[model samples]
Target: GVVGGRSVGVPGTVRMLELAHKQHGKLPWATLFQPAITLAEGGFKISARLNTLVAADPHLKKDPVAAAYFYKADGDARDVGVNLRNPELAAVLRRIAAEGSKALHEGEIAQAIVDKVQKHPTNPGKLSLADLADYQPKKREALCHDYQVATKDFRVCGFPPPSSGAIAIGQILGILKNTDAAAKPLQDGIPSADWLHLYTEAARLAFADRAQYVADPDFVQPPAGSWSSLLAPAYLADRAKLIGAQSMKVAQPGNPGAVKTSYAPMPDQPEYGTSHISIVDAFGNAVAMTTTIEDQFGARQMVTTSAARSGGFLLNNELTDFSFAPADAQGQPIANRVQPGKRPRSSMAPTLVFDKATGELLMSGGSPGGAAIIHYTAKTLYGVLNWGLMPQQAINLPNFGSMNGPTLLEEKRFPPATVEALRARGAEVREMNMTSGLQAITLGNAHGKKLWMGGADPRREGVVMGD
Candidate 1:
């Protein structure tokens, strides 16, 4: 499923960070990279998770460079606590710091990316130098929705398409709120069966709409009217009415507007891999960024500079996110089909919350879970806003949600009675590992003083630090 150039799309990370830094950075450009450079040169210990992942990946060993970097002389993965150095990476960072974004976007570095992508031994790609040179980062308006829980209300904002995050989360939460789901309390400090039932059903409905309507906004238009129409109160109420005490098992897409759309629903495809960052500056301006290169280690092609001194970054296989068949069996074109200059559909959900009445910033959060990103973000937001759990406590909760399929519960986390109860109500319960990496920061008052609370997912090697 992961390989050469066709899988590759123009890598936007360098451009994305460059734009963000230009807008909000207060420190000098070079100073911001000191920590990373230092770590790369000085070496850092490999975490258990990284070691396990390296041993598990079947393809990483295929790349000679990756194999050399990640494995030991005996051909086993480098063990946990081993100090791994990356002089190559350190060299690249220095160039990027000195020349800014141009170092990677143009000239020598860009050419190497094109070569690695197109010249892969077994799986060649279509990316070219022109594509790399033409890449442009876009800045769009963040999508915000007003959410009410009992007497408290808040405004939640998330990235808009080519991300299906905000729309899906907004749709699910909106539909749930239309019913009595929000009013139901957590039983024994866990989401009650009633709440989970509604939440999972809403997830199926939202994912149904997601598969049918969401795509790169530059290429695809929303169904009835604007994108906001999908989350409209009346529309969500109509959609929520379909949830009738039992799991629908699988859901069909809804018509969110009056106008007829032209695209077919994209078929189920495996979507995975991402990293999230949530930061709040002294000025109180916050950022939630969800970055990825499609699957782990991107297209599995790492490129070095012309001189081969600096180690390179992974290229993204983002194009694979598009519907491969392009059309359904009935001949209707899929909305998320690949096209030149079109970005792929994504599930990265970077979020910001605000007090609706006073417009004060409340929280920032995001996660990496492929299509389940919607459920993870919704779970965290609901935990913080509705249950008043601290960010770490919310993130530590078990992960559960569906992508319009079987109702999945995190393996071994719930009581046996909980699984049987769902099955009795028509849900096909699947228990397996649902590793969700979530990061969050929230603001609240304690002991008559305002405090900043931060949380990181225990599933990965992430830590929250504040001064």
Candidate 2:
């Protein structure tokens, strides 16, 4: 089963956060963790979402530590709105807050993590103490691209390689610009079938290039010696030419600058689970972050100092993000194939936008929908920048996207006519659960004063807050 130690990758959250705090944080390091500690120590009400996930999960109950904390004696999930505490997590947080990343990466916490992975009864992992201790977060250049809508130009920035986010998003939007999609506005607050047809076609082309070329930069080189080659205006225009009156159904990867890669395209596979956060602080600092554990309740294995403890956190099945089959039938290696010390290509696109002329911050946004993250984020950017919708209004629009296959729409959200319209174009349309947990905050003018606005996805339990 995917829910066990064999799926776990070395945890990186603590190290990543610590690195960010050290560089940009103004408050004392310990002060930053107090709220989470307080919440875990005191308790928080279980929401409908949590209760439903617990009840629905067939494997969560298999772990003794998780089964006890999240369920009743009868094995039913704890009731919604009931106060639940996780003192063990609180204890873990406290130690980390006090001792920095070392607490988790070097000593007691690291031991517990390694033990949980290596000693799993059914599926054991190879995580070692040295792996945890030696893990170092590397800061890479943010991929920024210039985008224009009508007369306004913006600079969109996103996470770089190892994350196929910004490059893919840039390609989609760039390709759309080469088409007439910009002229087709949203009909009644939702994207029209005409626009979606163009958008999904663009998505198919972009994803084709993604599976063919994107991977950890440390392992695979970008086509034509630069990632920007994929987003080049000339290249996008050529790609746009492929989209005719009908859907292409599936697209083949374009050779940017006529450059061919030795790697084979990764086959289509399931990608799942992540959360997004978009924040604009009082002092003008902003953060758009997307974190994940690769699957729901990730690996379904909980780790604490001891089984006697009632609280702990789940391990991530992040390694599974790699292409399971290392090579294709023709013997060409997949770019995202798993390798030691190599990060898997991901669709987590945490993004920020700035006014190109003045370099002023305009928006911070991102979404969690695994591979659909590219589409979710591109939709919000298009809605706000192209259609002039507010952040909340843009987020409230129904989620939709195509991952180079059948076009997907949020179930029951799109009109019947819209679905039939895509089908008429020889496109396969699937309306299912395209749940996107999108969060966005934009700088806007209100009553002739500068203001900050935030929006969260209503499909999931998220709320916008400000003091």
Candidate 3:
């Protein structure tokens, strides 16, 4: 069931992913888990943004664990350099790993979760005990959308519905790759004002469609065929009509969406959600894992009773991501509306692009970003297949995004000269932090040497692994 707004639901990726790790992991779960487990237990110094968010919550001051985890003894938010932890949380996680997820829904963790929700305003208003008991992590059929990279045909494939990232972003890029506007991105060598304009316009049009139609495939069927089928030359022709080559601005909606912003009291505030891993081995199988606390530590509930100080974490408020207004003239509340057993919409596009020749996984990746995820993957993919930047170079190079909102330009990445150029192209430019905090890997022969490369985002302190 949905949490706050239309929470993505009990993440299915965890259950199936755990099974996948057990089946294919080269290292034990204990080993792969060392980083986050250590960070959470010992407590990494909380990010400034996290401290600010926790203090913003009305309930955080009311909850003792929350108070200790985020606030100092003086009863104020922790300063930037301070370290923190919830021994209770570390214990819950240990139990989750040893006993498995049943502990989360129907066992000890479940009882606490039920009690918390019963006492909490958000869940009590939305979900019931039966819904929690009946909830099941989803298993979906794999999805594929056709694409062409140069003369060769490639299929960008991933799990459908609940994970809409791969299909939506892949389709967007696929269409642009074939567009006349994009034919000579690297060949022209130097990018001009016109090139950046075309790219930004194309992205904005694609994002508009995404916000309108994409949702949990388990509960609502997407338009007709898959989004890939909708990415035809004819369709691209229609989409390009929305972009202009001169200064422009998208009008924001006069009112807040979904639940009216004023009436929607914020839940205990938490930091932005994040955690991810991408793995590909010799067997040609690859897994890209993106985990989160939903907020800095999720719902701010810690499992107080547990066996060891090894397990426990904040739960997610992903429920807040759903569309509040529900429906239009067409009865499509699930357009992002929370359903009894539906997954919420997400930008998590753990993707695999294949050569189809040896059936080898050429590139497998994904990132941890809220809504700007599409362009984060797009910029990287273009550099890999089209511009031929080394994996790290592609990921590290300055990033840009035009996902439905304003054209987001990173501070140092876009020079003042480029900003003037983009502004000349009819775009409303917003200088901001546009990081997907991504990790990526390529398993193939480069210059006849067998190479596997990985790069993590420095923005949020991630590490790449290769042997």
| Candidate 3 C-alpha lDDT tens digits along 238-289 | 5555456563344211111232111211111112456667887666567766
Candidate 1, residue 115: the lDDT equals 79
Off by over 4 Å in 3: 1-13, 18-62, 76-86, 121-126, 151-153, 181-192, 225-227, 232-234, 241-272, 300-303, 306-312, 329-334, 444-447
The per-residue C-alpha lDDT of model 3 at residue 400 equals 76
Which is better, 2 or 3, measured by lDDT? 2
lDDT of 1 by residue, 43-116 (tens): 99999988988899878777666777788868799999999888788888898899987788788888878878
For candidate 1, the C-alpha RMSD (Å) to the true structure equals 1.5
**CA lDDT of each candidate?**
0.86, 0.91, 0.60
Task: Sort the candidates on lDDT, descending order.
Answer: 2, 1, 3
Candidates sorted by TM-score, descending order? 2, 1, 3
For residue 308, what is the lDDT in candidate 1? Answer: 47
Task: Point out where model 1 deviates above 4 Å.
Answer: 306-311
Compared with the true structure, what per-residue lDDT tens digits does model 2 show for residues 1-467? 46688778888888999999989989999988899999998999998988988999999898888888889989999999999999899888989989999999998889988988998888888989999999888899999988999999999999988999999999999999999998898898799999999999999999999999999998888888888898888999999999999999899999995445588999998888899999888888889999999888899888888556567888999888889889999999999998988888899999999999999999999988889999999999998999999999999899888989999999999999999999999999999988888999899997899988999999888789998
Candidate 1, residue 177: lDDT: 86
Better of 2 and 3 by TM-score: 2
